[model samples]
Target: MHMADALISPAVAGTMYVCSAAAAGYSIKKVRMDTDTKKIPVMGIMGAFVFAAQMINFTIPGTGSSGHLCGGMLLSALLGPCAGFLTMIGVLLIQCLLFADGGLLALGCNVWNMAFYGCFIGALLIWRPMMKHSMTKKRIIISSILGCVLTLQLGAFSVSLETLASGITELPFLAFVATMQPIHLAIGLVEGCITAAVLVFVYEARPELLYAGEQANTRQNVFSFKKTLAILAITAAAIGGILSLFASSHPDGLEWSIEQLTGATELSASGGIYRMADTIQQATSILPDYAFSNSDSVFGTTFSGIFGGIVVIVLCVLVCRLFKFFSRKKSS
Candidate 1:
């Protein structure tokens, strides 16, 4: 769930921004220490895939809330937590600055809520433990489902807490929690199933990538990683360009929860800080809400999805390269 600028006060937002930036810095260090050059390309492609997948918000039955794939757990499952977190930063940055999908002031909060929990807590505590002994289909599915559900629950709770801390009295704490938790639970279930299917496909096609760090010199699955990457890239194109058009029109889990509690989809914010953030977002966002600024045509939607995906890919690669460059410089 992407938090809007109104959901948080300047103080709370600033604190979270520092915390997320610190986390991002630490992740960059960890990834740089990891000398796996192969992960760079995979991270870039998977980030693009995540950007595309998030465009198609699937409808949750009977809930009137739509949810898209967060892709943190998916990325962590393949790239490991450090690389996964860095990749998610790229995804969220593109969405914040270019697409205007999330607020600029709330960018740090969004990254913390969406990316941190999935990459660290879900991947390390749940998925890694579940898959440590065996990488079977059953284990993969179980881990994926459990990890996705846990991360979403944690993320939803964090959102409520942050909103309360921001002094937004429109949404009472207990009621807001009650509404947000259940809706995100439904959303998490769908995400888990989708994640499981993708992981299973990768496992069957290229199990080596999953265990690449463990078996450093394995050459048996060299071509499999590229094959899987190609498949994922094509899947991203299809989903973003076509399937995104069919996404549910209902509010997402966060907005739906706010509506249930406050009877309003958008909360009002008035302040110099709010205005500045809005102005900057307006100036930077070429496509707002994943559609063209001037038109809501299907072509605009399709183009936004495809173009966003490409932008994320380039950004992710650049991030990886930057880290790699510094890492090498330090070594030499």
Candidate 2:
């Protein structure tokens, strides 16, 4: 769930920023020490895929709310936790500053809620333990579903806690939690299923690309590395460029929760930092709300999805390369 600036006070926002930055810093250190160049391309393509997948918000039946694939577990499952976290940051950062999908001030909260849990807890705590001995389709499905569900529940709970701690909204803590958790539970189920399908495909195509696959069969599969990448790239482009047009119009889980409490999708806040964050976001957001400013062409959504995916891919790859460069320099 993407928190807006109105849901948090400056103090809470700053605290989250520090915490998220610390996580990012730790992730960077881990990545720098990693010498696996194989994950570099996978990281970039998977980041793009996640970005594209998020553009389409699937409707949660009977709830009048929609949810998109969070992709954290998916990323962490494919790329190890550290690279997964970094790639997730790349996706979220572009969505914030470029697409205006999430507020600038609340980005730290979003990152921690979305990226940290799935990359760390979901991968390390759940998926790895479940599949440590072997990798099988059934294990992949179970772990993917369990990880997505558990991590999403935690993420939703974190939102309620952060909002209550901020004390900016009039939302009652218990009521908010009750509403958020169940709806997200439904969302998490859907995401888990989607994640399973993708992971299974990758497992069949190139099991060696997965975390524990090195211990398993490394024989030739139906798909080569380049073939798998091409397939995933094409799928991402199709989803972002065309399928995004069919996304649900309903408000997402976070906005829906806020609307239930305040009868509005967002609360208004007035503060120096709030104003400045909004100003900067407005300026930097080339495609606000994933559309052309003051236009209703609908192609704007297409353009945004494709453009955002490309940007995320480039950004993730660049970050990986930069880290590798510094890592080499240190070693030499």
Q: TM-score for every candidate vs. truth?
A: 0.95, 0.97
Residue 5 shift from truth in candidate 1, angstroms:
0.4
Q: What TM-score does candidate 1 get on C-alpha atoms?
A: 0.95
The Cα local distance difference test for each model comes to 0.86, 0.90
Error of 2 at 188 (Å): 0.2
| lDDT value for model 2 | 0.90
Mark the regions of model 1 whose C-alpha exceeds 4 Å error after superposition: 211-223, 325-332
Evaluated with lDDT, which candidate comes out highest?
2
**Candidate 2 residue runs with Cα over 4 Å from true position:** 325-332
* Per-residue lDDT value at 303 in model 2: 97
Q: Distance from true position, residue 310, model 1, in Å? A: 0.8
lDDT score, residue 196, model 1?
Answer: 91
Number of clashes found in candidate 1: 0
- Which RMSD values do the candidates have, in order? 2.2, 1.7
Encode model 1's per-residue lDDT on 1-332: one tens digit a residue.
Answer: 99999999999999999999999999987777776677877887888889988988898988888998998899999988878898899999999998888889999999999999999998899888877665677888898899999999999999999999999557899999999999999899999999999888778677766732243223245346678889988898888899989988999999999999878888889999999999999999888888877786889889987898888888877877765723443355
